[model samples]
Target: MRTIIENATLILPEGILKNGFAVCTDSIISQIGEGPFGKYNDSDMVIDAKGNYVSPGFIDMHTHGAGGHDFMDNTVEAYLGAARTHARYGTTSLVPTTLTSTTEELLNTFTIYEQAKEQNTDGADFLGLHLEGPYFAYNQRGAQDPEYLRNPEPEEYNLILAHGEKHIIRWSMAPELDGALELGRLLRSKGILASLGHTDALYEEVTEAYKNGFTHVTHLYSCMSTITRRNAYRYAGAVEATYMIDDMSVEIIADGIHLPKSLLQYVCKFKSIDNIALCTDSMRAAGMPDGEYILGSRDKGQVVVVEDGVAKLPDRSAFAGSVATADRLVRTMVEVAGISLSDAIKMITRNPARILGVDKTKGSLESGKDADIVIFDSDIAVQTTIVKGKVIYTQNNNLKS
Candidate 1:
């Protein structure tokens, strides 16, 4: 069946088009224009958008879990539950992120990824899995399990390649670790994205890693060094690498609690919207009440609690993660970070899609692209989420009443 969403404020990366209509056939957009699109055809389902903002469905490049389910659980229910929760907030596609864990645990999680890949559960499309650890520097481990942190081993990489499905899109590693550059080169050979994060590497080391095919910086500024007059060499760390290299995409957790509002604005000013990707980096406690939650594995210990929208560990040293969704991240960028709505939307959608090398199919609302769309009211609240022309989430007025 075909669908025509009329009278919408179409939000695009370039700009917004008012009173536009998007026509989708099967699972791809067929047309977009400013018009009534004539009378709806016999086979068409016409939706009155009522002046709401319609944009490409968000693509979350980094996210752990939600709705009381962590990806580290390595269970089908956990993955699907997180997907459903994020989909309700306007995310159409997401990478299920994993934390530092043992080799056996990672292999077990990959099996779960295979299962989730095979099944479509009427929620956000599971783009792939993101391995965020086991190959990081222990000093900057953040919320990752310190016990499981280690240098990348070729045999372990080979094992992951053999058992892991092609859906493993990106892997995060500390470039300074032994054999990591070689592992990064191998990952690039297989078309998997290699990202640098959770490390205490200097500027020269980061530049060397970039030359070896590390094209992304995960969660910039967090678990990374800052530039100072006394520590200028350390400034050449991930932040400098991200700013200097145009091809390198940096992920930023826009939740106000993770980064100071002033610093977040400064980053956006240095890096164009095209070079910055917004990520939730959320954990199991996202979309739930404040309480203790687990991150990597059961044996890794509990993550801190959520209070006043900030997730902190018991010692208050660093943030465990965030409870914000992709939609909320965009909104926060606009409301707090002083960014335009269109630019913020691009950070979450087109920018991340381009970084993951899936922009042609999933990013924008261009003709011939996947019909993954989101409709939200004026207040930036998600009203409906559509994935591949199928309505996955719709607001229920009865519940609200």
Candidate 2:
């Protein structure tokens, strides 16, 4: 099947193409150019984009769940609902994240992930699993279940690897923890992204971990550490170390609430667009009304409240997670961070795809890439989303066939 999207502004790799068009053939992009495509062939479906911006579909690298379902639920229904909910916000692909938990429960969730992928819920594609915790610094555990936090235990990680590392794209841990560098090496050997998060590591510790394979920093500035004074001596923390290391990459929640606009702009200015990726890090409360809910697995999660569209700890001390969708990420980057639309789009699309090592076929609207695309109006509101040449979401209607 072939579908042509015409009369739109396309956000392409080179730059923005005003009044452009793109042709999709089955599951791949066939052509993209400016002006009218001229008289095209028959047996094709044409869409009048009405000058909306056509961009590569947003790719969310970190998202727990949405639509009132948590991925840790270990049910196919929960995975599907989350996928559909994010698709409505232009997330064509996402990494289903897992909170800190016991090995048995984690394995069960991975099994559910395999099942969900095979079923193909027809929303955003589940790229792979992102094992977020069970190996983190107890002091900076943030919303994770602190009771289950511990250092990197070889036995547990070996068991997870035995389950097959192919199903996992990323794992986050505190680099300062004992035996963490060894675990980072092992994860790198298995082609997994070792990210630093929920930690109180200083600049030197982060540097040592980076050399061993911790190449990414998870949810920058959220649960991670920053500069502070000890005995009247200032020292660079994990956050500052990430900025200094050119090879180290980081992902931000970008909900505007997690970090102030000044911080967001500062990161962009220093880190460069290529090093940053936007993530939701959202929980089940996402896409649902404001209320109280659990932050991790339902049976053993921490109590959290959703107020003013953001999730917070029960006592309103720290953020539990974000309720933001992908579109919201883009909007916050543009409106609050004062970045260009093209750069903001790259943070969610091309940058993430590159980090996950799926850029060759997933990120851009270039020819020969997957036909995952999103059309949004000038205000950055998603109007239609196409995944693999099929329409998956539309603003006018709920979801597409």
Per-residue lDDT of model 1, residues 1-401, tens digit only: 88788888999756999999898898999998996778666777777777899999999999998888888878888888899999999999999998887788878888888887677658789888899988988878888878788888888888987877486899998999999999989888888899999978877788898898899999998887545355443245667767878778899998987877998898888887788899999988888998777765555657586777867887777788898887889888998998898998898889889899899899898999999999998778998888998778877431111
Among these predicted structures, which one has the highest TM-score? 2
What TM-score fits each model? 0.95, 0.97
lDDT of each: 0.85, 0.90
Model 1, stretches more than 4 Å misplaced?
A: 228-235, 298-303, 396-401
Candidate RMSDs in order? 2.6, 1.9
Give the per-residue lDDT of model 2 (tens digit) for 1-401: 88899988999998898999999999999999889878766678788788889999999999999999899888999899999999989999999999988889988887888889988647899999999988888778888888789888788888888885879999998989898999999989988999999989999999999999999999998788889899999999998999999978899989988888999998998897999999999999888999988877778777899997799988888889999999999999999999999999999999999998899999999999999999998788889999999888876543211
Candidate 1 has a TM-score of: 0.95
* Model 1 lDDT, residue 122, Cα: 84
Candidate 1, poorest ten consecutive residues by summed lDDT: 226-235
Task: Give the Cα-based TM-score of candidate 2 against the true structure.
Answer: 0.97
